[model samples]
Target: MNEPEAVDDLIADLPEWATTEEIADTMRVKPQTVLKWNKEYGLKTVAVGTRVRRYRKKDFREFLLRSAEATD
Candidate 1:
């Protein structure tokens, strides 16, 4: 499946933060699932504004690696 537009934009722009949609697209999951993971697991996030949420590339990669290790 094609990556979501928001993810493509995020990659092209190479922002310091990624939106929930961007991360969800990378994982091939729904945004809601991403939010759940953020809440249940330690998917760390930082707020760019009062409501806008974003994930750091480094932290997200670390989370993915840790999660993979957990499954293995």
Candidate 2:
């Protein structure tokens, strides 16, 4: 597969334990943008202690579903 296809596959198969940076890098968005989505969209997240935030792979899927629905 080409690089873009490999990236799509990687995102599709992402693990729940992956970090926000990993998601940001894969999606080509800023880390702050991802954090903003967590705050603004109520995207599912977990805290490692107090200050650190991590998003679930399921939330990413849900975001995609919501976006698709909105576009339709």
Model 1 error, position 68 (Å)? 1.6
lDDT, candidate 1, 16-72, per-residue tens: 688999888877899999888889988999877777889887677667656656666
Relative to the unseen true structure, what is the C-alpha lDDT of residue 17 in candidate 2, on a scale of 0 to 100? Answer: 61
Q: Number of clashes in model 1?
A: 0
Give the alpha carbon lDDT tens digit for every residue of 1-72 in model 2: 124444456577578765788778877899888788788876678899987777787676666556545546
Question: What lDDT does model 2 reach?
Answer: 0.70
**Candidate 1 clashing pairs, residues 3+ apart or interchain:** none
Off by over 4 Å in 2: 1-10
Q: Worst lDDT window (10 residues) for model 2?
A: 1-10
Give the top-scoring candidate (TM-score). Answer: 1
